[model samples]
Target chain A: MVLWIGGRAQGKLALAMQKWPEAKILDVSETDAKGKEELLRSLEDALKDERLVWNHFHLFVRRALLLGMEPSEIWEKVASFVDERPDLVVICDEIGNGIVPMEPEERRYREETGRMLCKLAAKADCVERIFCGIPVRIK
Target chain B: MMILIVGGSGCGKSAYAEKRIMELSLDGAMRYYLATMQVYGEEGRRKVQRHVELRKNKGMLTIEQTRDVSEALPKMQEGSKVVLLEDLGNLVANEMFGEDGAMTPWEIVADKIVMQLRQMNSSLDHLVIVSNNVFEDGIDYEEGTRDYLRALGMVNAELAGDATQVVEVVAGIPLMVKGKE
Candidate 1:
């Protein structure tokens, strides 16, 4: 698993595409996976392919939180999928840089997203941070 | 040498920048803290005060120039070796929106800021600039906020291009994006 992290519109997706042109690009942002079972099923299906670009994995966390699903539980499902697929590339935007949201749920989403990204980054075979469309391999 | 230190809010970029500037300074070399923020209320005042306290006994002078940053250049001492501009976000915002609440074209503001920063870099021995990662939030702000983000994004790109070194501090960990120590 290769974890690609960057700020919004920093070309994380473009880099992923450039690296894996023939890979399946599954944008989690467009996924309507509301409940845990739906999300797990969607993720499992996406990972079944040879190479898959999971764009906006952060949005999955947001959706999970919206559906009152625990972040750890979501991570468990994601971890299992990642463990099964070595050709998975997860792209996430770094959304924890801004001011903390005043809304409680928004704040929780940010925190959960950050934690999930960290865990993924630690376990991934490679981690790259994109800044201004420049890819820097951090791990 | 111009160093650009970037990071998220309260991620220790300021503290790290301060230490870096101090390390870069020579004995008897003049140091200036170019404060770009304009205090609006009690919270702002308290934040400024905290920064002031942090820099106390650091042998550095604070220059408050909310807008027209280049104007501060002429006032700097001849022996000034290092100047740490604590932020570029507030500077860009102030230039776009004046004290009287007038809005200026963001392109012009961004250009002016880049030009001013270039001038500062040319004049100073070591310039340590601090900037924030303003664009990662998914919230679709109003048009004005979006414009501000675009402007800031442009400014940051320019700064990074011109900088001799670029570092992003995350959780107090400085990740070198460009250039060596």
Candidate 2:
């Protein structure tokens, strides 16, 4: 799987679309997945094809935090899916760079998202960071 | 040449920018560190102190200019100079809201910064700017916060266009987003 990570509005989804024009693009940001399990199930079905684009995967992390789901548990499920299907393309925004949120839930969300991104980057065959519409291969 | 180094907080963008400046500086080339942050309280003071400690003995002359970055150009010597502007986030805030709590239009603030950056680029031997990545939080902030972020995003895009090299530092590793090296 290929992981594309970068700051918000850095053209990550646009680049992903350009790369996989024929793939099914699923934007989790617009999805109605209320919990981790539902999100994972939807992602598993989406990854059935040879090329599938999962945009804004960090939104899933946010939902998981809201549901009080453990990041490790979510990562385990995601790792299994990626292992099962190697042609997935994941796009996520790097959201942990700003000032620490004052709210406890926001803090937890940031921490969980950071940890999950690290794991995704580690497992993905390719990792690229987009900045100002420029894609830099990180791994 | 202009180099833009951007990243999240504590991602080592400052350290990387400083090292890049040092490498670009030659003998007798004046090294200036343009500090754009105004230390407000304990947290701000500690952050500034930590940055000072990080650059200790680096032969840098720190120029504390919270806003009006272009004004510092006259103070710099007329030789080969390498300047590392620590950040654009605080600079944008300072420009948007002044000392007396007056608000400048966001477009003007972005324009002013971009103009200053362009001016600095033409004058200096090497210009390395450090900026924070601020737009990834999923929450919809208030109108004021949203305006600030929009202005910052505009400024960063302009800087990236003018920069000869753009690097995003992650976990102390410099990833080149544009240009070679």
TM-score of each: 0.66, 0.64
Residue B93 alpha-carbon offset, candidate 2, angstroms? 1.3
Q: Write the residue-wise lDDT of candidate 1 on B47-105 in tens digits.
A: 98887766767888888899889898888878657899978889988888876888888
For residue A26, model 1's alpha carbon misses the true position, in angstroms, by: 11
* TM-score of the first chain in candidate 2 relative to the native first chain: 0.91
**How far out, in Å, is residue A136 in model 2?**
2.6
Which residue pairs in model 1 clash with each other? none
In terms of lDDT, the poorest run of 10 residues in model 1 chain B is B138-147
Reference contact recovery of candidate 1:
0.33
Looking at candidate 1, what is the lDDT of residue B170?
92
Task: Residues B78-145, candidate 2: write the lDDT tens digits.
Answer: 77888999789999999998778778888899899999889878998889999988777656577777
**DockQ per model, Cα:** 0.25, 0.24
Over A1-139, each residue of candidate 2 has an lDDT whose tens digit, in order, gives 8999877656567667777799888776677887767866777777667678878788877876677777777787778877887888888888876668899988888888888888889999999877866777889
Clashing pairs in 2: none
Candidate 2 whole-model C-alpha lDDT, 0 to 1:
0.82
List chain A TM-scores, every candidate, in order. 0.94, 0.91
Poorest stretch of ten by lDDT in candidate 1 chain A: A7-16
- Candidate 1 lDDT score at position B29: 71
